[model samples]
Target chain A: MDIINNLVKNLGDGIAAGIYGALGQGLAADILIMVIAAIAVFAVASGGFAGLTYAERKIVARIQDRVGPNQAGPYGILQPIADAVKLFTKEDTTPAEADFWVYNLAPIIVAVFATLTFTVVPFAPGVVGTNLNIGAFYIIAIGSASTIAILMAGWGSNNKYSLLGAFRTVAQLVGYEVPMLLNMLPVIMLTGSMSLVDIIERQAGWNGSWGLPFIVILPLSGLAFLISGIAEAGRSPFDLLEAESEIVAGFHVEYSGMKFGLIMMGEYMNALGVAVMFSVLFLGGYAGPILPPYLWLVLKAFGVFLVLMWLRGTLPRVRIDQLLNMNWKFFVPLSVVNLILVMILGKVFVSDPALFKANGGILIQPLAQALIMGASSFVLLMIALAIVTRRVRKDRMAEARILLQRRETNQQIAASVH
Target chain B: MRTDYAFIGVTLVVACALIGVVPILNYLIAPQTPNKSKRETYECGMETVGDTWVQFRAQYYLFALIFVLFDVGGVLLFPFAVAYNSVNLWGVIVVSLFVLTLLASLGYAIKKGALNWE
Candidate 1:
């Protein structure tokens, strides 16, 4: 019974111990364990990608009031497998004038970088593939590098639409990346660590209960991060990079067969990475009651993924101009202000050792501090919302005036003609 | 720290191998029915016009510039953020001033209409 209960908790350590025992604690054993861990993370990420695709299709289908993929296997559960087989067997095509090497290499780069992000993520206590000190920063760096791959796909395709898509990718991805980086600061400030595991550990309450998630404290940063994350993953309404109507499949327009599949896989993997990162950073990763820790992490990640799909199903893609404007004019400024606010709040409430110790230990002190921070962030959000609302209303009035003027001129022309 | 990074290095190599192998497998299994039209650049069923290396608008450069500034700034702030608890009031003040400078730059960019998509 204890083994079953502790099985998921100590699974990683157990595997490592078993390998060491078998191999007599040599360097070979360490290397073997690392390789095994890598493969395991790769497998989980790939499996999550496949499941995400199926879930997205089903959820979007239901949103559209249609039955989706009932034929593949038991409610189209095996649809991703069928899709994979079909893609693998399809004709691979490359344009004659395309940059042959880079065209072929971009998707591989995408797939590799997308999968690499899974390394620092903590699935359970003591179950990370690698607990890098700079895990959070490492993720951002990897995400930015993947942008270069998309640019390669676009430039190498030798297609106008692909080039256009690549341009939009730079504008959208880079613009949103600022706010995304900025939003992460508040969490880091409160937790005083950049490692995801440390952040998670910081959220544990006294007596091992669930402590206050950062989202409760820094709602503004959480909201900002989620929006920017959606854009970074290229989901709607921020998916201007590959808006099919405008750019015709964006950066990977020239890819065919499994190369295209690889890019698609990379994208879903990225979405999963973002979802998992959000859960780890803000949702008190792997910390919940009455369930395996890893299972809790997975559940939170899926919840985030479903929310992404819901947004995809409902929101229309924003125009490129609207997208960039929203990022620069709104999110960037908001995130900057949110970060400063959080820094000041942290200094005021959490800096004093005496005050921190006096309050009911780890859980209660942070909770009190977070309550104040949360209220301030809520007020900041409202102020920002009011400003945006006023700006939008003013723009609409000017637009209405122009339309009315145009209509009157047409009416006057009609009267003169009559 | 070294061992942890070794895990990452191993995972990276494995991930590369896994992703690299798939395309090779596709090449082996997938059909090769190459033809003139099939290999042509897709332009919505029309002949390809100008070169794909058309000059893009300069507006994208401005966003790139802003991104670089903010990205570097954010990275600089990370260490400060992580060490926020142990730092004295002066540290917090210095970081606030740094953030204020960033915000000032953003404001200048907005005023100059660098963010305008047009």
Candidate 2:
């Protein structure tokens, strides 16, 4: 390695090498490396999502113990590529009765949001496409555009199924985004930055774990994030929007070829971004040893993606009414309680930064804090369950008593009339 | 930001490249025969008539209305978290009250059964 470096150093022109003063040269090299990292991340993310669409189907199939897409290529390795080719070559047809402009643009919105999300995601320390200081905000803003895009596709498609699917999407998304945003609040509270890179960096360091787990510090909030993030990715038991057989593929009912492919790919991209975001927030993004940080990050994100698949495959799609009920009734209350706990946590800890500092290498003050958080969560969940369960049982008992009394009254009336 | 336009360019290029490969690939594997009727819009074994575009429910507007409030409320908390350490009691109260207001609205929606679909 030393010989190769010296040999390469000697081969460069004298003026170019001299202008590359140690400090200046390092700066220029860093910029070039940043550019390259950005490019590579974008390519891999796009291709990776395309590949993941295939993987999603395959994994879901295997869970059901079935062979999926076997005839395409070896182990279905070429399946995504083949699928892409087929979609592209197939005729781009529009319904004669459809709104052509919005129809064309609608498909683009779904694909575009999918691609644009790569800009804010960080694969490793310096590998992010662009570290917008408002990275989290950017994701929410750009990500929600797909809802409008989906709406456009559905409306423009001129199919009843498509319109119904589009409306379902608008409802499910609007419902789920409530809790999704509420859940994400605590992580930003702990990290104190919205940049994806900053959040990950705060959780990780050059040599070792941060010792403090985001999951530990903000437990219920983290779980809420998981629940809402699952919904955000449109997986079950929150996938009523795209409930196949019932909705006939929903709003994309009329779309075919590349247009359909774009919407499908968009779903996977949202999943990818969300899985990574979930990891960064709760799982200590890239906080591991023995493996390069980027690899660790992918492993963490992949783990989340698999959990999503497991959810979609195992749980039945929740009823639309129950889905909205859970959001408004359950998720809303828990998130509120969690937010209060987060605020209290912020006041107790952040008010005194000294507690977090290294004092003779002994972790200070946070152990009790973590225990209090745990006990608080256990209490809240139990109380919520107790309240909800009691109310439900009470209602059922009341109904049963009513039926019994009515039966007795009817029998008495029959005897009197006779 | 430069990556944005570069990606658009790449996708266009990829689309073109894939288009070029299809015919050769098709010759090697499958036959390319076009039946005129295949391109027609399918409508449950019936000859399609009239415009496909139709109006849908306006009720999603209610969902959208609730969405704006909560989604905006979610965004509102981001900046608050950044400056949380420096926030005073009044600041906390302000945000708390804001959250409380949203909670009330949600309760009203629930009681009125606006969230129910069936």
Candidate 3:
């Protein structure tokens, strides 16, 4: 047990030294590996886009009790490839009235930002493309680039629907992002690190393990993060960005052929990015028993993505007003309250001497903290439920009173006629 | 750690190149026989109408403006949260005050109906 654990722990250092030795101890080899890894991340993310569409169609079809995309290959596994071919062969259409430069530049910007997020995702120890100190924050910053890209597409397309779609997209993103960022605080507070790899590592080991994932401890924050994340991805029930019935595909309405394909690719890539981040931040990244770390991360991300797809299939799209209302009135307030609750709980019960390292660093006592936060969150949830129920009952009473008054008025009029 | 950014730079270039190259490749191999009709801006097959550019709602701008304030505040809180384990109770109290100020702004925004969609 000791030998295997030591080997597993030193895996990253071993790989680094091995590469250094093989490359004759120079910076060139590191750069070469970095470049290769960067390209690989791009390739994987793009491929993830293809896989996601297939998965989405299949899942939604099963939900609707129908077979989907079964023509192209066995069970439609090759449908994405078929899609790529069709998109490639279709005529690239550019509107005569469109702004030439901005129209041409928007798709590229979207694709680039979508791909940029992959740099910070750690699939396993020694497996990340680059582990920046501000990995979590960096993801958020990179995400903002998509907003600019959407605006460019909307304005450049020279279409009313596209412009309106862009406007809604901006509102949805801005509304949800505050709560999303706030929801992340508990994770950061508990872990005391911003680098994703470090966060994962802090959740490592038997005694110090935070129950294998932060989500287990902070369920309320986890729920808030998931919902906000879905909004951020522009997925249903918050997919007002491309609400086809209202705006005819939103910001990308003007794009066709390969350009349209690029826009779709960016969207799917963003979804995959969110899934990966959620896995890393809450599900303990790549930590698991028995299975390889990278595989574990992949499985967890896939599981999260599946849940997202399930929500997409089951829920109807919300109107733009309702969408904004949900975010501002419900999610934002809940997230903030959750953050304060977490902070208080951490301060009161989580600052024990045993939880601190001899070197003044803190080790999360997962069991203790989980016991505290879980109970607090449940109490918080119950309070929210109670408030909602009370408001509902009050509304029902007012409605009943109005109905009774109308009935009495009708009875008096009948009596007067008799 | 700083040098790791070079990887990101390379990744950006590669991403741009991939997006740029694929469409150009499609243009190269795909038959492009565009007539005046094909080149026209696609509406649901109606004749070209007035200018395509139209005014949009300012409600989006309101949310974005508020987003700017909150996002910056969130960024400021990042350091505090990252160092929370080591920070003393006084430090926690001070940061809590900072967060409370942010919450106060949010409450003000709510009271002003800044979040009202209609």
Candidate 4:
């Protein structure tokens, strides 16, 4: 295990060296290295889908107290391979009225966009692809393409269900994106950098070597981000795009053979990409004790993914109206407020030169600031809960009163008639 | 930066090729026996009705427009947020007022029931 860990840690350097040797060092080497990195990222994104499928099945099975996919080679680890082979061998079909160009292009767009997000995710200290200046917004910009891709699939399929599914997807994904972007505002404010690597570095320890992750400082922001991001990634509870019971496989209903496999690959890759982003933004990417950097990142991302599978197993899918309402009415408002609160609180307390310098850069004040933010957020949540419950109770009481009054009036009329 | 674009361009082209190649591989392996009924648009074993391109509700357009408004506004916020620490207090105030406007618009939208489902 230790040897494997060491080997994994050195893999990036080994690949870089190999590229340099092949291309000769300098500008040419840099470009060639990037090409190699891109291919590696693509492979990881596509292959990660198979691993995610296995992980999701096993985790959900464990949640339900049942074994899953154990028949196909050692606890079904090879199940995805078998599934892939089956898909490859299955008959490919196109609907008579389908728009062939758009139909063919949609899955390609989805897959490419999904892989593109991997460019910005920092697995370790030096293991990032490009770390572009606009790293944060780049993810959002690239992610929006999935909406277009799904629209293409739906419209091009010439299936009513697919079109309806595509519309729902656009509505849901777009709605959730607002809150997701808003939720990241606080993280950016605190870190003072849009780069993922910078965010992680800023989150490193104030006094001691151990860091306080962004989630510790702004739990409300983290919570909001994760919820909306899950919806953005089209996971369960927001899996309206492929709501099997309702839409008959949804936007990709007409897709078959390897095309269908490509769509599924896109789905899982998007989820994995989001999970990596979650870790980078909130959990302090590549910052942990004892473990290798990439290993820490993988473990943290896997932890997030496990939570996603747990959510899939425990929660039922929400109605489309309910999904939109949650995004717009609840999450959007809450995220806005949370962002404002963090910006204000962070500016006044945590970033103040007087308090921070007076304390000689001790970690105590940062911890105190985090506690204050957490306490205030909790108070706000409780107050909101109280107001909502009171409103619901009043509505229910009024409804009951109306029912009773109607019954009395009916009884009086009956007596008078008699 | 130019190199970064090169990387992205290569990745995209390769990814597209990979997606295309998979289906071609399947085409080579899989049998093709297309029939008239098999080629018809799928409607859960039912015959074709009217055209499948039905117009969606206007609400979707409303959401998309709202999303565009907020998303573009949010993109503008990222620059200010990243430069927050180095900037002066007036810079903070300016951005705060900007965010306040966004919040006010959202609140107005909610009060007008733009987000209501019913």
Q: After superposition, how far is residue A144 of candidate 3 from its true place, in Å?
A: 1.5
| Cα RMSD over interface residues, candidate 1 | 2.3
DockQ of 4: 0.60
Using TM-score as the measure, which candidate wins? 1
Model 4, C-alpha of A154: deviation from truth (Å): 0.6
- Candidate 2 residues lying further than 4 Å off, grouped into runs, are A1-39, A205-209, A349-364, A385-418, B1-55
Candidate 2 chain A — worst ten consecutive residues by lDDT sum?
A: A355-364
| Runs off by more than 4 Å, candidate 4 | A1-9, A26-28, A206-208, A351-364, A385-418
List the pairs of residues colliding in candidate 3.
Answer: none
lDDT of 2: 0.70
* Per-residue C-alpha lDDT of model 2 across residues A138-239, encoded as one tens digit per residue: 777777888898889888877666777788888887777777778777777666788877777765631233355567767777777788877776767777
lDDT of 1 at B45: 90
Cα deviation in Å at residue A91, candidate 3? 0.2
Local accuracy of candidate 3 as per-residue lDDT tens digits, A1-418? 4345344336645665777788876778776666667778998898789888998999989997889899998999999999999999988888777899999889889889999999999887777878898888898889878988998998898877787788888888877889889988888888888899987886674245433577777888888898898899889888999998888889898898888999889888988898999998888888888777777888999999999999988999998877887777777777777887787677766545754542233445657667778878878977876886787689679989999999999999999999
Error of 4 at A109 (Å): 1.0
Off by over 4 Å in 1: A206-210, A351-364, A404-418
DockQ of each: 0.70, 0.26, 0.61, 0.60
lDDT of 1 by residue, A162-235 (tens): 99999999888988899999999888877778998998988765223647688888889888998899999888
- Give the higher-TM-score candidate: 1 or 2: 1
Give the residue spans of candidate 3 off by over 4 A: A1-27, A209-211, A351-366, A388-418
Docking class of 1: medium
Candidate 3 docking class = medium
